[model samples]
Target chain A: MTAERSRLNLRDLLSETAVALTARPARTVLTALGTILGVGALVTTLGLAKTAGNQIVSRFNELEATEVVVSAQSTGFGDNTRSLNVIPWDAQSRLERLNGVTAAGTVSAVDVGDDLARSVPVVDPQGQTEFQIPVMAASPGLFGAVRASLFTGRYFDQGHEDRADPVAVLGPAAAQRLNVTRVDNLPVIFVGDEAFAVVGILADTARRPDLLGAIIIPNQAARDRFELGGVESVEIDVAVGAAELIGAQAPTALAPNNPDQLRVAVPPSPRRVRSDVEGDVNALFLALGGVSLLVGAIGIANVTLVSVLERTGEIGLRRALGATRRHIALQFLTESVALGALAGVLGTSLGVLAVVAVSATREWSPVLDSWLPFAAPVLGAVIGLVAGTYPAWKASSTEPIAALRGVA
Target chain B: MRSLRRSRGAPTPDDLDDGPLEAWAVPTAPAGGLSFEGEAVPVVVLHQAGRTFAGPPPVEALKPTDLVIERGEYVAIVGPSGSGKSTLLHLLGLLDTPTAGSYHLDGIDTVTLSEPERAGVRAARIGFVFQAFHLLAHRSIVENVMLADLYRPGGRDRRRERAVEALVSVGLEHRLDATPATLSGGERQRVAVARALVSEPSLLLADEPTGNLDTATGDQIMALFDDLHGQGLTLAVITHDRSVAARAGRVVGLRDGEVIEDRLVGSGMR
Candidate 1:
């Protein structure tokens, strides 16, 4: 035989294989559905899980890659053990001013703002647009530490903090909601009593990408409006190269070798309980996804075995054609992989569609977090191959002559 | 009666030259009595071939068959139902294992062949036809014929051409695309014959090729077989049909697992 014929033989074998499957496509598709759906669910869920997991990691990285956040004892008896409480803003400011130290800041969570909604009467050619933004506060240098630079206006200095000016810097979402051309000269109504002018507008970034309507004010001005009695969360930064030296200089009274992420509260607060609930929900879905993958495998096995039985004569014909056992097995495995890949691509599209639909309906821009698109189809293909192997093995081992006679 | 005389080596009148002449009878050696020419390669040699199935007190399907067929001679094996005709064909076809025997097919003893090796021999050296025309139902006539050599030493186009040539010999060239089911009983049998011939095997062993057709149709298939035989193809047709048996130049008849008759038939028998 010519080399061309030999090289082209495998393609013929595969084409024959595909044609054989196509002859009874309804049954074949029925057989493959479970594996497809199972693999689909597995891959799609894994995609989402990876998305969520990297989101939390990004959030952790968002705190600052090189710095360690220092926490204090709780204000009361119950608080999250993992939650980093208030670190005394004055002490934090002093640490920032230390030699070689970069900027540091304390974070204050926006607990239920009482009716001080950001109101803007935005006018377009069609009609007027109105939206509201929640207000939040942060310590001085929060912008510098978080790297939220202004696009149009300047950040509040010590003067604004001292004077308690009715001024605010707008986040991207807040600017968008106000329908404003520029935050430099726009007035936004705040609460039932007053209107505040936007001093600065935050720029969009990948680090903390999505936008939610909100206004950030100076910590001093915020204290006048709301109580800063409980320190919700804290963030700190170390100088470029002083992390090790500073850790060593800590008082010997506190054991230096012990890990520093110590959460000392005996009981958890409502916020801690809420985060726990969210974690449980995530775990529950992940567990369901794992079980569905297993069910999908069983489905694949069932279909493959039945398909082999149905195509017993075809198997004999192929074997009689000088196909080795490995060839038969590889063919079936290839078919399974193709089906699984198809399902995975379809399932990923469906999942993304589901997320997009939710986002559109809820009016919340859900973060897609990086790394999910590449991981989905590969997982689907692997699952398909593993699930199809045993049945294909059984098919490959069937005796050719007996198969011709249609004997078991 | 020669009484089934078998000598290990060639039993000859040469022993009379030195020893007592009474042990063997020979007046003057007849000039070249019963001599075979060309290669004495023993294309098939079965030494004490035995096969016994372990069922209902071990039914022995084949006895210790000591037989041989020369390279280019058409030999017909005739037997009744369960007379071991099919079993003997299988053993010679390299499709079954002998419980005890040295079956040397074409100078290669098959007792030592692996399964794949046995199948290879079956594919390359022997072709078989079944009574029911065991063609793949799903494929067309040409494809059915082509399958015999699809995985053999050729490309698909060449194999297809060979299959078409074979089909043409049996006069089914016009029905290449028709499925076997669409062909008549006689035509289907011809297609089966075409399939067996496609591989160009050294031996063609057909089991009851015309047993299922009418007299005229049966005669047609037998006529085709005869035509192939005249073309110098060595063939073995297994059947109880007297006419089909009558067509062969030499017929070896089996009764109760033993050769009961070996004779040359005349055209009047058909």
Candidate 2:
């Protein structure tokens, strides 16, 4: 009989807890909203941070694993500055002969005698000075190295580079500035009194983003017309895990006697980037989640206290029914924990939904913690248990006679 | 020492009862009540039991007094307001401790029991009904009766069956699922009585059970009490109304925290 009674106590407790909560549905729901918002904000922030961080680290790893850049060190300022170890005109061919080298290309800035190239024969009557376009000379492989995509016409071939024909391609920005949208018109742009026929307009580039705002001409043309020096920079793509090795070998390959004069740049190791990004993302959102949880805890405490005050008569009745002080305290604590558990379950689902929506809108793959949905409700319940301590104690301490006086 | 004296003499009411014999409106319960075999023990025995309030004035709420009530007896403690009728009831119900003297309930020394132990005794042996009917507004009449069983050592199904039987005994079986809010004043009081009876306690303690009802409704409730008393259930009612006191088999009157009169009604010396 004693065992059966004790077993039924749990069922009785739950039934009584449910009755108490349902007695004031509006108050219970409003009180639970605090935990809902807290948990939802926490989970949503976590989901977004992981998704964004994953994209950044993946891109960083991909670039760091395969690409290396070698630039000639500048000895002085201005157009007269001498390159201590200028990249050889045949830098691409030399680097390609090395193991693990997939592709290589050369690029050099064009010095147009301190004058900007203009498509118009004369200046506009309004005297607009917004079209100061910069120009660059590129080899054929530079287009492949930089991953450039053409918008119109065609890229200049090896035939044009070998004959030194003054053919050019305009970047999207440069093309807009020159009022040349299509290559069908065969537009001519003068570079320091020499006219070059525009062959193509580039839409975008992967490596050399700065090229979007400049014009490109054949390297042979720049060399013959302007007495251009050797290539200013060589960009090389190698197989994964070969960046450091190839970075060391490319400089020596380009300038065997002056390898120290060239600076080879490769991205930082992948391990470092992953930790840095993860740390930043976790720290930022964790604080926000913590603050939200604190506010939720306060809300639960406040509501539990108010409930204890309102149910003083009920407490007295239970006491009269032979409920000990501990029993009273346990009953109230159970009600609090039940409220928090409800909020946790609802909040976690809402948060997960929000994450899916945001990730879908941003075109990112959502990443969620595997155990968070199950753990969150338990955490909320624990918070409720802690928060209810004072109120439950106050309830249990109520003098049975004094409480009954109010009821009578 | 009191228990030793009682054991040595084994005195019945005919030998040396304290209260004087008198005639009253109600009759005593018949002999052959549900008698416990072996030895008969009074349900309540108070020897110089008194309660004092800890106050600026140190008010003595109940004066030291001796009282005894045997099983199957109907008793009423009658007094005006502030006469300590409620105080004496509080002591009898185990809701408060006396500042002076010892109290023995069901032949067990109660003064030595802890608060929780007192609560356990109350759960197993005493049933209380109040004037206001104190039914939980959110629960049905059946559920209200079932509250008593939650504290008892039994299966839920058995407890529920006992609650249903108690409600049927109180003529409230048809209104089992009706919440207190939907019940009339007299019906609500019946539910309270059913709740008190559900645990099959040894003694029924009621304080002003008809204080809040209309005279007609109050009379009906008193009639229900008389019927319960006729069935060999012991009852103690504390009230200010002489008319309510007239229906009991015995009456003890209080004035200024002291007992002024004690009397038996009808042909009642068991």
TM-score for every candidate vs. truth?
0.60, 0.65
Q: Which TM-score value belongs to model 1?
A: 0.60
Candidate 2 local Cα displacement, residue B58, angstroms: 1.7
Which runs in model 2 stand beyond 4 Å of their true positions? A1-8, A60-292, B1-37, B155-157, B266-270
Model 1 regions lying over 4 Å from their true place = A1-13, A47-143, A146-408, B1-42, B153-157, B178-181, B185-187, B211-217, B266-270
In candidate 2, what are the lDDT values of residues A1-408, reduced to their tens digit? Answer: 001111127888899899988988888888888888888887787777766777676786665578888999988889568766468777878988999888788888877676667785656688653456777888877777777899998888778888999999998998888877888888898777778899999988878888888888888999887777768888787888788889889988999988998999987667666667767777877787778877887898899998787778777767766677888989989988998888888888988999899989988888887888888888778877887888889999987666766754
lDDT by candidate, in order shown: 0.61, 0.78
Task: Give the worst 10-residue stretch by lDDT in candidate 1 chain B.
Answer: B21-30
**How far is B101's C-alpha from truth in model 2 (Å)?**
1.7
- Each model's DockQ score: 0.08, 0.14
lDDT by residue for model 1 over A73-117, one digit each (tens)?
A: 443345433234334445345556555446555556544345445
Q: Alpha-carbon interface RMSD of model 2?
A: 6.9
For each of the candidates, the C-alpha root-mean-square deviation to the true structure, in angstroms, is: 13.8, 13.0
- Candidate 2 is scored at a TM of 0.65
- The prediction achieving the highest DockQ against the true structure is 2
